[model samples]
Target: MIQFKNLTLRRGVKELILNATLTLNPGSKAGLTGANGAGKSSLFALLMGQLHADQGEALLPPHWVVAHVAQETPALAVSAIDYVLDGDRELRELEARLAEAERDNDGVAIGHLHAELARIDAWSARSRAARLLSGLGFANDAIEREVASFSGGWRMRLNLAQALMCRSDLLLLDEPTNHLDLETVLWLEDWLKGYPGTLLMISHDRDFLDSVCSHIVELANQTLTLYTGNYSQFETLRAEKLARQQGDFERQQRQIAHLESFITRFKAKATKARQAQSRIKALEKLERIAPAHVHSPFDFHFETPESLPNPLLRLDAISAGYGGKPVLDNLSLSIESGSRIGLLGVNGAGKSTLVKLLAGELAPLRGERIEAQMLKVGYFSQHQLETLREDDTPLGHMQRLAPDAREQVLRTFLGGFNFHGDAALGPVGPMSGGEKARLALALIVWTRPNLLLLDEPTNHLDLEMRHALTLALQDFAGALLVVSHDRSLLEATTDTFWLVGDGAAKPFDGDLEDYRQWRLARQAEALRPSSDDTAAPNRKEQKRQEAELRQRMSQQKKPLLARLAKLEKSIELLTTEKAGLEAFMASEEAYADDNRARLADSAKRQGEASAELERLEEEWLALQEEIEALENGYPQQ
Candidate 1:
């Protein structure tokens, strides 16, 4: 458990978080969210003791172990398993000490060593380490692979696995899902949901947060505001709060205007002078709540040209692969103007290969590929940042891309994508992945291409940024082809699904969720028991029973829907109660009543509310899964 009391953090003269008080209870899962550079990672660093607060205290339980996985990974060349196993450094040291004691044949030291070994063994450290490593996507073979050979993305996963292996009482993860593939991310979600340790993570993965976290802590305007429920619920509540604040501000403005008018009219009147003065004083003393500033004013507007009637790119009977191995064999696909297609597949399912083929970066083997005349294609590769000059500043890059543009205009453009002042002047090499992605996007928008090809465009973006990009794509008139694992982004941005599997490309008439459900069902079937026992029913009978179960699952949806609704209501109520309690606790007046009895009462209520919220959330998630299964049974409209 950890607590931050009256904490204030600043960079130079700019305050990041001010007067922030928050508690991370045992087994609590909290999400830190806000716009980019709102100090989400800074808050994590503050908790990790990597950065000290300018004021107040970060309190931790005595001897509580804490581990943090930062956004940027540290350089290491050790094997993945070796790196993860290093998390138990303390236990390793104890083991070494015990070995030395045994060699020395010292009775007292050996006795102490035996007890220490017992204590270390009591935690079942080895089993935990193995489980954590496996859960994070490190297989037996990958565990031995040198980390230096892995890509930056895989290295980040290695870092996460290492952090999780620590088995610390408190874990602080910054963008833990940034590099994870869909399956690994889901595995992590399950792990975190069932984890008994306290967790505070900064993640843009909505599904991950919705599955794992019960509380949302936002860093804004140099302060921390805690919200109940996950990211979606937080968004709903935040919008409502902002609306209420705006209304209150307008009402106050009207009251102040009337008071000013009265004061002006009654200044010389003896009878009304005192009342008018009193009203003036009250108006002057009123604390005006300023409207929240929009983080960036640069609207993202994609100017897509009118769709061409002809097909831009076509692949017929194609076989694509890497290093002499086939990934997609005998595949046929066509891309025409006005098509917004989403590629859905597992990590190694040839989706990226398919994109490369469409981009003309890879030549198809034993097939015909064609490109329409005057095809101006803008390809946003997964490694698009590699196109950027590491030594060049964002502004410099922009200016070079559009040399005729004025300096002020260039700076304004960069700022619109969240690169402001000195930030725009910083080298691209040092920028975060999200910043680089935004810069890449800004550059691409400048080119104004008619055919856009993107691979994982939402990789490093926050929810708002992702949504903004989705909107821009939705409005674009160009033929768009995107390969991404982000379900929501794909569903909202694309009109059709291009599934790259079974050694070919096939068109599916639905969103990514449809693809996901199809995959899940296939996986579930694959995991189902195979006929073996003599007493078991015949294969056809078994198939009939499975079909019946599927039918029953599809038909028995009403009770689950009702249960889902009830759970939603419970979640809403618990969220409201938690928010009220937090607001009350943050008030100065509440400190005056900080006696044992009052504190105990508040703590009891908080605990109850938290427990109830967690339970309801779990039930809600299960109901959602059931609904997803049922929805998969219906034909796509």
Candidate 2:
């Protein structure tokens, strides 16, 4: 557990956190959410003791261990397992002591060593380490791989796994989900949900927070405010609070205006002079609430040329790979103009390779790849920041991208993406992921290309910026080919889905939810217990025989079907109830009835029904898919 009391952190003249008081309870999962530069990461640093506050103090649990995983991982020349094993310093020391005791052959020392070994063994340290490593997406073989050979993303995962392996009293994670793939992220969500220790994480991942955190803490205006709910609930409550504050400020202004009017009108009157002066004094002494600073909205628009009649890109039986290991084999697909396509697949499923082929960065290993004539492509790769010159300022980068453009024009463009004033002159190398992504986007937009290829464009963007970018892409009249695993982003911005699987590309209608269901069904089929036997069956299975196996399987099918039916019924009932509530809540008369009590009740019921319906639907769909796969044989789509 950790607590902050009147903590004020400053970086030179700029105050980062002001008078912040917060507490992280034991076994509590807390998420810190705020706009960029709002001190979320700074608070994390303060909690980790990496940065000291200029004023006040942080009260921490006595001798409590804390493990921190920073956004950027340090480079190390070591094996991944060795790095993770380092997390258990006590266990390592115990092993060393035990070795010494065995060498000395002292009874007392051996007894102590045996006890220590037993304690370490009781903890199941090896299993815990393996679980943490696998949960963070390190394949069993990759655990022994040298850290230096891995990419930056994999290294970040290694660092995260190491932190998780520590199993400290408190975990401080900053943007922990940034480098994680969908599977690893899901694993982390489950792990954190059941995590017994205190967790204080700064994440822009809305879904992750909603799944794991019990409380949302926001850092804004140099202060921290705790909300007893997830990020979405916090957003709603914060908006309401701001509205109430605005209303109170307005009421005070009205009262002040009345007092000033009375003072101005009665200033020279002999009978009322004292009262007027008293009102003036009171008015002057009143403490005014500063209005909230509003962020300037960036109106982004991507212009696209006329749509091509045929597909802009076509892959004819193409195969791509690295070092002769096939990533894609005999893949064929066509991307049409004005199509908003989302590429969905598991990690290392050739999605990135496909993007490269579309971008013309890689040639097809076997077969033809073609692009339409006059097709101007603008791409934002996952590692697009690498393309930027570290020595150049933002303005300089933009200038290099558009050399013919005026300096004033370049500055204006950079400012639109929140890089203004001195920020535009800052070196690009130190910029955050969000800033770099925005800069890359700004450059892409300046080119005014009709074909856009985006690979995880929402990687580091905050929710607001993600929404803004989604809206911008929605309005753009161009062909979009995006590869991202963010469901919300894909659902909001994509109209078509391209599923890369089994060495081929398949197209699907609808959004990510549909694809998710399809993928889950496929996985269920793949994982379904099979009767294949390379050797003799075990005694337990042989005793059951084929008849008993069929009977058990049949019995299992019945409950699954019944559960599916119940879920369907629940979904239907909730749908009707939600609709009725929405109809009543939308009526103006409902608000006038008994102080809007009926409307309030209807709104609450609607929310509950909607949430329940979503849960039931997800379960129902998963069950139905599983049952269908069990009933029918597995067939490749």
Best by lDDT: 2
Per-residue CA lDDT of model 1 for 1-637, tens digit only, reads 6788999876433577788887767777899887776778667766666566678988888787888873334346776667777776677777788788889898899898778868767357656766676666554445665665443445567678778777588888887776455656766877788767888998887877887899898887777788989888998888888888888888888887888899999978999989988987898798988775534444676775644546888888888764345677888778888888887765556777788788888777669888888677788864566678878999999989999999998887777677889989987765666677899999988777778899878877778778778778889888999876566677777888877776877888665456557766876686577777853557567557545654665456668656765666677777888767645544445556445466556656865675566545444544554453333322100
- Name the 10 consecutive residues with the lowest summed lDDT in model 1: 628-637
Candidate 2 C-alpha lDDT tens digits along 1-637: 5778898876433577888888767887889887887777667766666566677888888878888874334346877887877776677788788788788887899898778778767358777877788667566556766765454456667778778877588888887877455656767888888877888898877777888888888888888888988878887888888888888888888989999999989999999999999999999899986554445445566766654545788889999865344568998888888888888776666677788889988777798988888788889874566677767888998877889989998888777787889999977755666777788898898888888899878877887777678788888787888876566667777788877767777887756556656755865686487776732456445445633544545665778656755665676777788767756654556657584777767767765675566545444534644553333211101
lDDT of each: 0.72, 0.73
**Cα displacement (Å) at residue 466, model 1:** 1.1
Please give the TM-score that candidate 1 achieves against the real structure: 0.72
Model 1, residue pairs in steric clash: none
Residue pairs that clash (backbone atoms under 3 angstroms), model 2:
none
User: TM-scores of the models, in the given order?
Assistant: 0.72, 0.75
Worst 10 residues of 2 by lDDT: 628-637
- RMSD after Cα superposition, model 1: 16.4
Question: Which stretches in model 1 have alpha-carbon errors above 4 Å?
Answer: 70-78, 106-128, 260-284, 293-298, 319-330, 363-366, 389-432, 446-448, 501-503, 507-637
